[model samples]
Target: MSKKVILITGASSGMGKETAKALIQEGHTVYTVARRIDHMQDLKNMGGYPIQMDVTNENDIQNVVDTIIKHESKIDVLWNNAGYGLYGAVEDIPVDEARKQFEVNLFGLATITQKVVPYMRQAKSGTIINTSSMGGKMYTPMGAWYHASKHAVEGFSDCLRLELQEFNIKVVVLEPGVIATEFGEVMLKNISQFSSKGAYSSLTNQLVTATKKMYDKGQGSKPTVISKTVSKIVNETKPKTRYRVGLWAKPMVWMRIYLGDKLFDKIIMSQLS
Candidate 1:
């Protein structure tokens, strides 16, 4: 396989960092970015370029793209992976907070994609890998805003794939379920702060306990699972438009599909009970 110049966001840790390391080891020129640049010094030490970037900031996104193009002359792949999970009851989460969720998880990804697409289109060949979640396809209690943002990503990526087909830019969505990352800590933190003493207090407590139990028991798939998926998909000439990997991703999606709304709702709520 030819060594491709790649740009991946949210690369300070977790799946993004792992994938960046794997790609660099394979001899690809990789530019990794996140809001926390210090978290990525190890990646820089491994021959990957690390940049401090906030996806919500347009100037930061533009600068990262410009820097990559200046050095590599072209970008062969863009992995839009910079996102966080916000969990709380809809009524408990302020409108501004909800908007911020969309800004990071949906709009930010889109803005970065917009910046990179022109370069890919000019070259007539490139890949855009978007990191979504099984939550995009399924839903859980007290997670309305988070799921809404991911759902938007699913729709946005689908439309983008159709639009970019003529340009030969492949758009792929990754739906990972229960990866063992700081995702749980971040999510629990947000939920506890927002709903720990509201109408949703009981639900919040149950969610926190259940989430902790799941993670403590090591139910989450390792981050390497997703990193390997990134490696495999980039090598494919005609990769699938969407990949549902990691533990429970496929089954949860299947359950949501085959079961009616009432049954699926019961199943999901039972987990919190």
Candidate 2:
């Protein structure tokens, strides 16, 4: 296989970090970008280019794109994976905070994709792997903003795939279920303000407790599972539009499709409760 130049955002941790390492191991020139440069120091040691990037910053994103174009001449794969979950009821989470979540999860991702698309178009061969989640397809309590962002990604990726087909640009969505990561901690921290006396308090606590338990018990899939799936998608001659990996992702997608909204809601509520 020919060596490809790949750029992955959110490479400081979780699935992104694992995927960057795996891609580098597979002989790809990997450039890993995230806000936490220190977290990616090991990646740099392994020959992966570590780029300090806050996806929410338009200038920083544009700079990364320009840097890639200047050095590599072309980017074979652009992994849009920098995102976080803000878990809280829609009514409880501050509107501005919710908007901030969208800025990072939706707008930021879209901005980077826009900057990279022209290069990929010129190359006429590239893959864009977007990191979505099972919540994108199914409803989950206390994850309104996060779910909305992933749903947006689902739609955005679908549209891009259709539009870029003629240009040989493949848009793949990686939908991971609950993975053992610091994601839960970040969600908890982001929604702490909404944890007191409200209609959502009990539900929020239940959901948080369940999430903590799952993480502690190691019931969720490892980051490497998703990383391996991403590697396969990047390396495939013809990749599928969506790769739903991890334990509950497939089941959740099937349930959402087959059981309808009401039943699925009941199932999810029961699981959290």
Best by lDDT: 1
* Residue range 87-177, candidate 2, lDDT tens digits: 8778878889889989999899999999999999998999999999988998787788899999999999999999999999999998999
The residue pairs found clashing in candidate 2 are: none
Score every model by TM-score: 0.99, 0.97
> Global CA lDDT of candidate 1, please?
0.94
Give candidate 2's TM-score. Answer: 0.97
lDDT of 2: 0.90
Off by over 4 Å in 1: none
